[model samples]
Target: MKIERTQTGVRMEKRLLKVLKALAEHQDRTLGDLLEGIVLHAFEGRAAFGDETLQVIRQLKAVYGLELTARDSHRLEEAGDDR
Candidate 1:
């Protein structure tokens, strides 16, 4: 097997770590590769959550009796609409 190495560290909750490990194993990827992809995606300014995602978050907030700021509401509305 080829060995790839990099120096980096990120702290995640233990439960999140377990889930990541399981997903990596299921996909036949090393944890490092899985994490690298995620980091790269975020660095590339990809939306980790899109329209449906924002809707879900808004729904959850509503269910918990939370209110969004005007800016947040505008952002969510923008996210919902196709540009």
Candidate 2:
């Protein structure tokens, strides 16, 4: 089966976007495919991926430079800044 896709323009939080792209690469999938699967799973009230995927995401985050820890994110938000 083949699916047709249209390119769409969108804006998002930079860090979030970076993480998503990294995750896509980590899973050996295209960004669009990964996002589609995630959105569709969410629509069905299911988890997008499992613990194994999360472990890969953690490793890929470092590889792709998406290393913003939760604490770091909180500190940035508290300071009203982006890093």
Among all candidates shown, the one with the greatest TM-score: 2
The root-mean-square deviation over C-alpha atoms between each candidate and the true structure, in angstroms, is 11.9, 4.8
lDDT of each: 0.62, 0.78
Q: After superposition, how far is residue 28 of candidate 1 from its true place, in Å?
A: 0.6
Give the range of the ten consecutive residues with the poorest summed lDDT in model 2.
74-83
Query: What would the per-residue lDDT of candidate 2 be over residues 7-74, giving only the tens digit for each residue?
Result: 98886557668878878876798989999999999899999989999887777677656767757754
Instruction: Name model 2 segments beyond 4 Å from true.
Output: 58-83
* Number of clashing residue pairs, candidate 2: 0
Candidate 1 has an lDDT of 0.62
Residue 73 C-alpha lDDT in model 1: 40
For model 1, which pairs clash?
none
Distance from true location, Cα of 56 in model 2, Å? 3.0
